[model samples]
Target: MASPGIFSEVRDPSERVRQLCNYACKVDIDEAIPPKRYLRSGLEMMRMAKVYQEEGNYESAFILYTKFISLFVEKLPKHPDFKTAPQADVSAIKKKVVASFASAEKIKAKLKERYTAIEKKRQEEEKRIQEELARKQAEEEARRKEIEELEECKRQEAETKWLEEQEARLQELKRQEVERQRQQEAAAAAAVAAAAAGINSGAPPNFLNNQIPSAPPGNLSYIPNDFGGSTKLVDIDSQPAGTGPIIPDRDLKKNLLINDGPSVSSPLPSVDRTTKPPAYDHFMSTGSSSGNKFGLRDVIIPSDLPRKFLVKAEHNTLKNIETCGILAGKLRHDAFVITHLILPKQSGTSDTCVAEDEEDLFLYQEPRDLITLGWIHTHPSQTAFLSSVDMHNQYGYQAMLPEAIAIVCSPKFNETGIFSLSIERGLVEIGSCRQKGFHQHNKTPPLFEDSSHAKTVDTEKIEVADLR
Candidate 1:
């Protein structure tokens, strides 16, 4: 360290202190503030360092920089009181430190270029002000020009619209003329085909045709099966034992399966009025040309279902929660009997849940030899609607058994709704939809077991057996 030559020479204490720092630390200060204290404000140290470096005194600048780095940039953050200081303030100090660390020659060039930059900015500001004044004057000139252009554009638009209207009218008339000619040609072709058929059958085509006129709109109670086509109803009991398999009626949509013998003479099947056969729900499908699709045409719950299961579901419903139970039983005669109601273990909130112990529940059913028919659950709201999760679960059940159904009981609304995937529309849509969680479905599917037809099992025949 250099010796302080001002060893009691200056009368003012501030001046003496400045001399001491200048001599000992190679730093000069305008005031007598301590070097360490000045460096405490990192920005102040940076300004002092720049001043020293620009003035060709590199030693003082580097010393001040070393003090600034040690005190503010690094050590201050580790102190408990300053640990939580603003990050932005710390970053600003860092940037200044980086700028001050430049070489002496680099610092001189940057400082000299700064004055030139300020002058350039002043000139730019003056130029911008002049351009704004010029633009205000030009706006008046453009006003008249814009009005002339606008008038010319309006005239062009009017002319274009008139031409378009005329073209559209001509095209419509041409289409009507083409349609008139097509209808006349079709009538002539039909007349020729009818006359040829009359000659071949030796009778008028309309007379030989067994087609009946459709009923008036007021008389349409139910659409006769096969759209009013004359059909000889075929009953299974009426078929003779030794005869070949019953030939399916044409509109039955069954495959053209021929028997192993010679062809039959009459295509008409025998009809028996005494048979009380089950009525089946049917639809016309065209996606597949051969084979008819059948679902459980209708499901009839006895007017006497056990009340215990309903009692439990009603309890959960009142509390605005949910509960699920399974309906399983043996296939008695031609229908399913609800002999058991097993409430399985599950975890869910008011909206959704997963049924666990399904494998075990199903395994137990295997020993009892009962078929898993359908499932029933209660909703807090009376809407009795299926959420997207409900649909996915139904998809698995429906896939396993085509006749499987979903029953939703909304005790709040006193609503019980039954739903099934429409083999044509419902099953195809639900089976194809792979989305999960709450999602949108197109429409409510047709139900094989509707709430309106959910007959209560007679109390006399009702019995409760919990297999939970």
Candidate 2:
């Protein structure tokens, strides 16, 4: 559909006014109008325009002012009554039209100033939000870097301490080796001195009485002697006090071999176990055991919801007109709970109801942090089921929240039911179907069904706002 006017969305007030004037000049006016009727209509229109201006409705006032000036200044000159009117009346009308034109100019300037200020404030707000986000991201990055540096420092310190311990072990092993060799050399010299004394005294060599000193107390290994089949102790070291028996040389070397790479001392990355997947908790709740496996949380409705909505729609029901209301609520304890029913300003027929001024509805819900769970509408004379229009509307709600449900009240039929699209088939079919208004769908696999995830609770009260 075309716009109501060519200048409707134009941002520049002067340009918009120029376009409107051009369009108005082309509009045909009734030439048979009486002078008194014209004057009366102009007075009423000007009065209304002043009222709109005083109420801070500058756009409406500007449009009215423009229309008034256009009719009097552009079209009135062609009117037969305007030509034959008294000279004084014509001059008065001309003066008023000129005054109205001036008023329109002032209104246009005011509108431009108002819109410019609004745009400036909006831009500033957006800039502030972007700066805040950037500041937070910078702080987070700094923190992440600090954590990494701290972990690196700790890992390096651990590796350095390990190297120092290994160095100390090597020094102790070298000292023990030197002590063992010195003891062996002293024992061998004493044995040779005793044998020389025995030869000088001419007595039988008392090798058994002056025996050589035993080597060490640790696990011993012997080497073959050149003199016959006898064996002699080679290198050995005593066990350190209080430590378990010394490891053998071969086993000790194997244990001391460095690994292929340094062992890392950094901790494993932290996991946020508290964070739950967006909507999984709802379907995984104990109450949602019977629903389809789409993992949507159960929705709790007030038991008195149907009765309260019916009472709100009583006037429309009696007149055989449909009444619709938005269902709004909050998520609590892993479930969506209906807390408010908002009836927006609307017009309805027997089978259709359209809520208007939806921005007003958003304004009302925003401050309270309300979620649009779904909607409730009366069927009036029809049965309690969703029409094609309702299906499309519900699609939007469900898209916002998979568990959203539509409630239909049929006062004449004494029926009330809560419903949702069949996730397995209905949601897809209705989402893809483009036909608007009341229409038919395949009944073989029903397009909608009773919502298994929604149940009524009598424990809480549901608030109502009749914006109408």
Candidate 3:
């Protein structure tokens, strides 16, 4: 429909219907209606049609227009005043109908143009809104990436500072240890010297009472009667000696001398000493069993999985095993179980076709004290030593719960196998088997059975197509 004029000169269908109904009701059954009134009613009906057409109510306008034309034709032939009325009036009414129809057409055309313009504007607005949203999302992503980069940089800086501090402490410890050794040596030397001086000064001399020959006779000879009594002389060498004093042997003295050299020469006392201030034992005990200085588990652990899983598993048998495990553990506990949903990409019909379903597994966490024996999944193949995908999944899975084992099942025989991954001497391996229940007699030995083979696997390069 064409756009209506600002003054509403165009007629509307409902108005036309009301005008017709009014005119028809006003018609007196006792007296014949006047031609002017009938003509006025027709004009009003036409005006209503014009309004309806302008407003894009074509169906109602068409119906009203048809009724007005039919009534005008029917009454014009039989009315008493129809013949007496001025021909011009009849002509004017006819012209007005034609004009109204024409106006209705114009209104329709204008309306179509307006609708087209409005639709185009709407499309443009939607596009603009979408572009704005995209721009906002891009900005948000960039901001997030920037924040992450800043955090990583801060972490690296902290790590570097920590390493430098540790090195400085180690150097200081070495310096203190050297100083202590010097002091100990000095004290030992002083003690050895004191002992040596005491020994040298306390020894007894051998020259005692020996008789000299009679003073070489010469000096004159007066022999007294007292001197004539028996003269007895004892030689220093002739007496039988009692047990001699026990002196240190030469070897013993030599050893003591060598050992005492550093002590005697140094200037510091021999004593235990340390430069570092004493610290409380408890301070040293603050750390994880994994030896990681940072408590990464606190940050990476999932908070929502347990609650959501439990809600979804009220009727399911497996009962969201992982969620159960998470709840059983203590609050803010270190333990968490993560499961990855994996799907096979290829039908495995042909060897040449590379499977596209080789996507990484989705990770899900289980609640604590769940008494779960690790993750369980069915394998398409008969033999299940973790496939390349499985290994990749398990390794990442184990990072969150290193103590947990992985269970792989083969649906055909209902056979299930479990494997544990561990790090040993800087190498990743299927370290040990706690228990492998299925096909117990099978030749495959426990995990640690072949060290060489485990070490040969290059686990890092394996593909990890994250399904998430």
Judging by TM-score against the true structure, name the best candidate: 2
Model 3: residue 66 alpha-carbon error in angstroms: 10
For each candidate in turn, the TM-score is 0.35, 0.39, 0.27
Task: Give the poorly placed runs of model 1, Cα more than 4 Å off.
Answer: 1-300, 304-306, 444-456, 459-468
Stretches of candidate 3 exceeding 4 Å from the true structure: 1-102, 203-468
Global lDDT of each model?
Answer: 0.50, 0.67, 0.37
Q: How do the residues 228-331 of candidate 1 rate in per-residue lDDT, one tens digit apiece? A: 43333333246444321222233432222222333223234435332111122211100111111351412345444424656866666666777887766654
Q: Order the candidate numbers by lDDT, best to worst.
A: 2, 1, 3
Q: Of the pair 1 and 2, which is ahead by lDDT?
A: 2
